[model samples]
Target: MHIEKNILDNVNIWLTPTFDEKTQTEIKEMMTSSPKELEESFYKNLEFGTGGMRGVMGVGTNRINKYTLGKNTQGISDYMKTAFPGEELKVVIAYDCRHNSDTLAKVVADVFSANGIKVYLFSELRPTPELSFALKYLNCHAGIVLTASHNPPEYNGYKVYWQDGGQLVPPQDGEIIQVIEALTYDQINFKANENLIEYIDAKIDEAFVKSTIENASFDTPAEAKDNLNIVYTSLHGTSIKSIPDVLSKAGYSNVNIVPEQAIPDGNFPTVKSPNPEEPEALTMALALAEKLNADIVVGTDPDADRLGVAVRDNDGKMVLLNGNQTMVLMTAFLLEQWKKAGKITGTEFIGSTIVSTPMMLELASAYGIECKVGLTGFKWIAKMIKDFPNQKFIGGGEESFGFMVGDAVRDKDAVGATLLICEIAAQAKANGSSLYKELQNLYVDHGFYKEYLISLTKKGIEGANEIKQMMIDLREKPLKEINGQRVIMVEDYDNSTARNLFTDEIEELKIPKSNVLIYYLEDGTKICARPSGTEPKIKFYFSVNEPLDSIENAKEVENNLDQKIKNIIAEMQLQ
Candidate 1:
């Protein structure tokens, strides 16, 4: 139970008068009876990653608490003052349905307001995208949201956004971290200036909803909208209100919500985790879809930024669609709708992440629309949107079940994505088809791409070191082949270079440097390895594709692709 000298020093700092009485009492208890816990909590300060800060909720420097939040807010406040000198600084703050989210949000607003920055705080809990939209709509310099997107209830997060309505990227994120690291606990101003804190009214909500509606490509026919039985669950988060409101406003009257999950509960009582990426998270929604004989079922994460969808396949059974399938289906549908509406101006473009299905590139190419790939996270996708002001951004998404339909909200918007998905389903129903069938049609038109992801969780300090070493080992000894297929290309994003294994020629990568390694096989297979920035885990994404000439062979083709990915995993010893 011996604590390192540095850890003990860090712990003692919190026991001082600088911290509140409650925090000091907790620290004292940990020091006296729970030295191990104290060491874990004070081993190091919670890292402010490229996007923002996230960690388990507790009373320590390494954990997310009032003090950590205060320090971060003050750092942001100082950065804002310096970033925009001599101007009236403004920031919008929002929170999701997480423990201490509202309180943390208030603390954030207080810090901003105390620093002479105007604060537009949401009157109540709202989705992350709405917060992003409000930041832009209100013309604020920065914004913050209090919620870990899909993490467990014990975990919470702070996501920062800039004026362009996207998460902070590049020099901005690095600059903010520098400011945060230079400040001490006592430097933070936790006092509130009530006069400078303003509650965002319903006007912002109305505008957000309007923008979502306008982003819809197809108008749901009254008959299809009325007859389409849609089952949705917010997974006990912020989308409970916004999703239904947008669906109802979009002329959908037959929407059925999972009653148990409709309530906003940070505990996520009904499911093990609130993430829609896991099929288990959508179990209740799928069951409801079965009972209601619905056409489609959709669920959003706690923060309502990512979406998970399920639709009745041709076999008359409901099945969950992976993040890649959802993106492909939605992207194809949007392209078709745009083509039909004559909105394809040859200047339109779409975007996806490197880990997402390569079919996105193919789909965009088929329609003569540009497709750009970025590193993981929607922030990179938003950066692409910002980079292409001359070209229209139709949609963008990643394989993590996140999607952004239009530029209105730069980040992945579940509310708008849900609405657009329903519209796509309704349009399919109107055409005597279903979303599953549409997916099959897309596969038939383009190629069939199947994607699978495996995430290995490594916790604590030792685990972090292990994960770091794993990445280093992979970089030093890159994979030469996988599953009897020759490795054609190796992309080392961390070093910002891509090399052709066959020719030994190298080229610079256009994207920012990230600790990710991607391998391209000669048989059109892709394997991506990257560690999570916010969580203690490493993720490997596998994507394999083949031509699908007929719907009758879809199951066989899909099974083959799945087996190929399994073989790749086995050969790579990832199992």
Candidate 2:
């Protein structure tokens, strides 16, 4: 019922004439009628995280609004001018189908154009990966895409990409944040220079689709493509604009779109959430797949940077694959493609997150390539491409439903990934195998690995404190065992140290510092605790594996692994 003094002070500033009349009126209404909402909005400034800023859309300091994004653009404009002095600084802008994304993108473009930076804006909504491709294609200094990437309907976001077409990382992200922090909202230049802004049309789209098809297709026979019955859905997001085009151009003619979820609507009327990671979001797509007796079903998030896939199991029933399962399938398929082409000469590598199944390392070893594991987020995987300049980046993905094929687009690209998965499916079908069968083969060759994710969301100030305390407790009073499995090692990414519980040996982690902790069990199970950098949630990742002697017992083995995870969760009292 009571608001803090600092929150009240922040709110009162928004009521002044310095802000627009509508914003002022909204602030006043929140203060008088809904103090809790006002507190939530003005308690703190929305942070520009390493990837970018994302929050609910509202008239507050912690919201994604014109002034917040305008200030970010202005800061980036200033930073780019300094970073690339005396050069013709250019930036590409794109937006998703989120509400006000178009207007907000225009406002950002106006800020950049007003600052004398040349701007190339997408004439319409496009996939987030295309924006990354266009940034490098245009040889621009930076890129911005306005998308919440499958968050709730009330949310929006801004993600900044560098010249390498990867999201901002390390020193650059920190430097930009410092500059933006030094300025106020009024300092943003909203004036537009029409001459400096150029709207790009279908030319870039054609180039992007061509590049995706070229990079993803492995020359599957035309008969195989025709035999692969595919059902696709955009989940009421931006993929509707380009997915079908890419699939068609790639010579796949049997693609069926989920009609109820095909339109690009910000309201996302057809699903509970636009995120493909959630199974409920794919209900309509799954139904359509069953009706058509489709061999595979593919769905993309709002921005199309991530995808969720479904394939028929050995029993001939449609089953949705988790992010880790999809990652494993895609990574293994790409590695095999490279090997078959004699491209695996030992300098090639793939990228994955630490929280992902360690099966990636097994796959990498079998192919005689390296698996570079980084912290969570595709940005770090993108960093891998930039970090290892000489070694080839075949493909990479995280436990989250994201995959990036090759280095064409330095972000997770569902557009290209969809085509790549189809190639795998089509080729397998032609060879008397299904996608699920290929996955089973992978598990048999390289030990069967099962992964599960649990996210605990705590909202508002009290929730933030609770999450912080939870991490502290985990550090101070560490778990020695889970479900009677002895803890063999503990990896504290926050402290950048890995301790061997048995011998008490500590070694420094050679990666960037993140607030993540992982425990390795003697039974080859890995448990990780990490707080979401972009959301108000703490995620626990569990990976358990077993040696599969034969594919015949794969089902029974998988069931035991599933029960093991459930027992571990119950033992940890996380339920």
Number of the top lDDT candidate: 2
TM-score of each: 0.98, 0.99
Q: What lDDT does the true structure give each of the candidates?
A: 0.90, 0.93
Which residue runs does candidate 2 get wrong by more than 4 Å? none
lDDT of 2 at 300: 97
Best by TM-score: 2
Q: Across residues 535-567, which tens digit of lDDT does each residue of candidate 1 receive? A: 999999999999999999999999999899888
Instruction: Write model 2 residue lDDT over 473-547, tens digit each, in one string.
Output: 989999998888899999999999999989999999999999999999999999999888778889999999999
Q: Lowest summed-lDDT stretch of 10 residues in model 2?
A: 45-54
lDDT of 1 at 27: 88
The count of backbone overlaps in candidate 1 is 0
Q: Candidate 1 has what TM-score? A: 0.98
User: Each prediction's Cα RMSD?
Assistant: 1.2, 0.9
